[model samples]
Target chain A: MKFGVVTFPGSNCDYDAYAAVRHILKEEVEFLWHKSEDLKGCDVVVLPGGFSYGDYLRAGAIARFSPIMNRVIKFASAGGMVIGICNGFQVLTESGLLPGALIRNTHLRFSCKFVNLKVENNATPYTSACRRGEIIRIPIAHGEGNYYNFVGDIKALEDSGRVVFRYVNSRGEAAIEANPNGSINNIAGIINEEGNVLGMMPHPERAVEDILGSADGLKVFESIRAACASLLNTVGGK
Target chain B: MNNDSKKAVVYVRLKDGVLDPQGITIQKALVQMGYKDFLSVRSGRFFELEIKADSADIDRKVDEICSKLLANPVIEKFEVEKK
Candidate 1:
């Protein structure tokens, strides 16, 4: 399956995302620039983490209006898979492809470190490779990773099983101490109502290899690959 | 003496019941340091502005800033106190 990673001007994680897909997962990966409107015939599109546009006007505010986002939104709406990591998640939220907004870290500082995340739900295409309640360690580097939505919207997300991950302690227990960025309900990641788009604060690309001290994040990519492959097979057969 | 001299203090804060992630993070750190007496914490932004516009105009300007730039109305509320 072909995987496409969008690169904005200041997107530093594009290479890492490409490396994880091309070298680690051994998938056909393409790097698409932010200005390009076309997704290059790829089934899965990834918005990797980084300080896009220097994060000048809010983390993902400026990047959301990029020309390529139009196509990305259409692609996602059409039931294609789209994943946004960190600032990518910010962009997705700003683009209205995902619910909620990313606010400044409650501590009002940039956080950079490894954090434990509990898989809240494994039914979505992004987390289907992992079992429910599994804990994975990933790195999160952001100044605005706190997620907030209306209480009613949050309840709907919880009811619909759209919450995919939550901050957790090393023991896999949910607690405020495990929350590095103060996301609501310790949310580390979430999916849209349609289940095709995912926006998460943690960077899976940085944790996909053993050399990175963890290969736990590989399952996220693997899950997307399997889901996209199944989708392609279904389309081909039809 | 300037007739239009006026000052306003703008207090921006997360709305009630909205999660203050940054504040929660700090509260946890403080607790780790054994400062357990703190019941809750919330962080906010404060801005003091001296403007020459009329009070009505100042109110409108403050609203513009709150809606467009200074504060995200989706999760925050801003109050302008005239001085």
Candidate 2:
């Protein structure tokens, strides 16, 4: 499957995502500029992490108005696959493709460290390769990763199983200590109702290699590939 | 001489019940510095917009921008004041 990594002004992880897909995953991938409206027929779009638009007005706020996001929003609404990482996650929320908003960390500091995340629900296209309750170590770097939603909305998110991942400790338990950014219910990632889009604060592309400290993040890419291949096969059979 | 420029200020603030870590941190700092009477603090931001004085729909335009770009309605509420 072809992947398109969007490069907004100030996007630093666009290369990381491109490299992960092309060099590691060995998939066809290209960079999509913020000013271009073309997605280049990519099957999946990856909004890589970075301080887009210098985090002006608010993180991901200005970037949401970029010309490229219009296409991304339309593509996602049509059930296309999209994965947003870190600042990308912020953009997703700002674009209204996902619920909730990420606010300042409860501690009010930029936290940069490897944290364990438990698979909350593995049924979505993004986490299909993960086993429920399994813990994987991934690094998080941000000062405003504290995810928030209305209390009722959060309950709905949990009840609908749209919550895809949660912060967890070594034993796969969602504990307060493991909640690095003070996200409500320790939420680390979530998927849209259609399950076509996913937004997560952890940097999976940064953790795709064991040499980079952990290879656990590769499963996310593998899951997407598997899902796409099966989808292609089903269409071919018809 | 004709002056045609007008100014509008938009205040964006986090909704009540939403935790404001920065404000809380400032409150704590105040206590540490012996300003203990300051029990609570809230933080917000404002934007100044210059618009045409002759615009008939200035209010609507400012409100639209406040909702669309200046503030995230989900977590924030914005007030537009014309000056």
Candidate 3:
């Protein structure tokens, strides 16, 4: 199970993502530079969080045009697993790999804190480890974390089960107070139509270690590993 | 020159109901300065463009820029006014 984490020029969480997969999960991990056009032999490609390209011309705007994005698009199209976290989520939406868009926080301020997320759908490979409606805590830090889609489009996402994660409170209840960045419907994460590509604003890697105060995030990575292992076994059997 | 007569104003703003993180930051600063009268503030981009194309074609070209480069229609609203 070789996992690859893409590192853009200003990416700050590539190491964190690598450590979570390689050291914590004890899975084979590699660094894929933003300019690299190869994704051979990689089971999962991660777009880690960071202020890529200094976020100069809007978050993920310039990074989406990078040469490597072509490869990422190809990988996703072929049913490959791809996860984008935080700023990485911004990039996915910018590249049209994901639907909707991340906007400035409704409060118009950068928010950095642990947020409770409700697993809306666990049927996909990314959230198979999580039970539907289960609440998990993850840290989110970003200026543009608010997510929006047309009302009709949002309805479609909900109907299609693409609306995966929603912000919640400590008591496991959804409310305005728990809506950290004012994302519509409190959406913290979503998946593409194929369910192979996921983009979320929270940082699961940051919560993977118990020493960091929580190990809840490990379930996310573990789930992916399990899914990939099963996939490999299925291919071998065939 | 006659060609410079075509002008347009481009108004780019974040979609309604979406958060304006940068605008919120600025509002906070203004509040600290004792300007408590402001209920809310939203920041946006404005461009005054003069093109060489005639009115008939300029609208289409400007629309392309708005959808492709000037503004991301996903989270932004853009308005064009002839000048």
Candidate 4:
């Protein structure tokens, strides 16, 4: 499967996502410039982590207005799979592709470290490879990773089983201290109701290689690659 | 040519119940500096825009921009002032 990584002007993780797909996952991947309003006939689209547009106004706020975002939104509306990581998560929220908003970290500090994320639900295409309650070590580096939504919306997210990943400790417990950012309900990632779009604050692409510290993040990509292949086969597509 | 450009000042602040870590940090700093008699502190952002004079319906235009771009309605509220 082909993966298209959107590259906003200030995006620094484009190459990382590209390398993760090309080398680790052995998939076709290319950089989709922010100004290009095309998906390049890719199976999946990845909004890599970085301070897009220099995090102007707010994290991912300015980058949301990029010319390519229109096409991305259209693609998502058509049920295409899209993944947003770190600042990309912020952009997804800003673009209305995902629910809620990402605000400043509760500690008011740029958190840069590896955090444990437990798979809350393994039903979605992104996490189908992961078993429920399984923990993965991924590096999270962001200053505005705090997720917030209205109380009703939070309840709906839980009721609908859209919360895909939650911050947890080594024991896979969603303890308060384990939450790197003060995301509501310790959310590390979430998927939309349609399940085609995902937004997470951690950099899975950065952790897809053992040499980079951990290869646990590769499971997420592998899950998508395998799922997409099966989906194509079921639909009689190559 | 007349200077028909008008200014619209916008103030964006987090909604009530939403935690403001920056505001909390500032409050802590103030307390450490020996200041007292404070219920709480909140933080916000603002923007100044010079509207073109020929643009009609300034109020609606400003409100649209504020809600759609200047402030995230999910977490923050924005107030626009014509100047």
- In angstroms, the error of model 1 at B9 is 16
In order of the candidates, what TM-score does chain B achieve?
A: 0.76, 0.92, 0.86, 0.90
Question: Which is better, 2 or 3, measured by DockQ?
Answer: 2
Per-residue accuracy of model 2 over A1-238 as CA lDDT, tens digit each:
7899999999999999999889899999999999999999898999999999999988999999999999999999998899999999999999999999999999988999999999989898888888988888889999999999999999999999988999998988889999998999999999998999999999999999999999889889989998888877877822
Q: For candidate 3, lDDT tens digit of each residue in A39-135? A: 7578999999999999965799888888788899888999999999999999999888998988878776689988899998999888888998999
Residue pairs whose backbone atoms clash in candidate 3: A106-B19, A108-B20, A108-B21
Kindly report the docking quality category of candidate 2.
high
Task: Name the runs in model 2 displaced over 4 angstroms.
Answer: none
Top lDDT: which candidate number?
A: 2
When sorted by DockQ, best at the front, the candidate numbers are 2, 4, 3, 1
Docking category of candidate 1: incorrect
Q: Interface-residue RMSD per candidate?
A: 3.4, 0.5, 2.3, 0.7
Candidate 1: Cα lDDT at A5: 98
lDDT of 1 at A97: 90
Better of 2 and 3 by TM-score: 2
Please count the clashing residue pairs in each candidate, in the order shown: 3, 0, 3, 0
Writing each residue's lDDT as its tens digit, candidate 1 over A86-173 gives 9999989887899888987778789999999999999989998999999998888998998889889889998988889999998998
Candidate that scores best on DockQ? 2
Two-chain DockQ for each candidate model: 0.23, 0.93, 0.49, 0.90
Residue A22 error, candidate 3, Å? 0.4
Stretch of 10 with least lDDT, candidate 1 chain A: A56-65
